[model samples]
Target: MKNKIIGVCPNCGANVVEREKGWFCENRECRFVLWKDNAFFKRLGKRLDYHVADKLLRDGRVRLKDCKSAKGKTYNATVLLSCEADGRSKFSLEFEGGC
Candidate 1:
């Protein structure tokens, strides 16, 4: 059967589907997910939405507006999608020339 394109996993190009809490990759090996309660986005008074998920899945990076800095400052920046050594996803802010 053909898998429906609900969403795409940013890591493995697998199908992603929305669950009660978030979106998850269908492949167990590719455990990429965008959690609604992600602390990073929560701090910014925002939640991970469909657009963010779609962009991260297709493009490896996404530009965000009004993101809160850990130091209690707010700014706009590009968030780069990366995978950790443990096969988990990691997000880091990218500045002018570096992360």
Candidate 2:
């Protein structure tokens, strides 16, 4: 089966397609990608699933309702998506009331 088109590449304006291991920009020169088993999300006790990935690509942010802290406390936050100079994805969290 052919890969599904997920969104536009934030770096190169190419089509972002879903692959087995990750979502990737179709432009050969673009390094933009979102790995399914991303270490960043893993650290937050979350998997980078399709819904979150789609929202991040389309809106550059997604609200995570139950993020577990290292100490096992659950909290809600908005995850912001940004691109690095090399087209790699970078993420940060925004918490309510300066958490």
Candidate 3:
């Protein structure tokens, strides 16, 4: 496969690469990781797929197609990506009326 430009890392601002398991910061100094088995998505009944990772890294946010809410109902929402001062990345969801 050809080299693909995944997106910029939120922590160190380096380029992120897509591997078999997840997206990783190219810079060793950064040590940022976004695992595919992230619990955030698993609880929502979804997988942390490549497309979502790409969007989050590229734009700092991604619109999920469908996700189960706390009520066991499916809904659409935007996921916001942010990095902590300690170089850890996290994800949060925004609903229509703002969760």
Cα distance off (Å), candidate 2, residue 77: 0.9
Q: What does candidate 3's lDDT look like per residue over 1-99, in tens digits?
A: 854558888888788887877788888878677899999988788888888888788788888866987789899888899987777788888887763
lDDT: the better of candidates 2 and 3 = 2
- Candidates ranked by TM-score: 2, 3, 1
Better-scoring candidate (TM-score), 1 or 2: 2
Candidate 2 per-residue lDDT, tens place, 1-99, comes to 999999999988999999999999999998999999998888788999999899999999999888899999999988999999999888999998893
Report each candidate's C-alpha RMSD, comma-separated, in the order given.
3.3, 1.2, 2.1
- Candidate 1 worst ten-residue window by lDDT: 1-10
Which residue pairs clash in candidate 2?
A: none
lDDT ranking, best first: 2, 3, 1
Task: List ranges where model 2 is wrong by over 4 Å.
Answer: none
Clashes of each: 0, 0, 0
lDDT of 1 by residue, 1-99 (tens): 543456666677778877767777898987677786777667765677878767877787888887877687877877787776655678777765553
lDDT of 1: 0.73
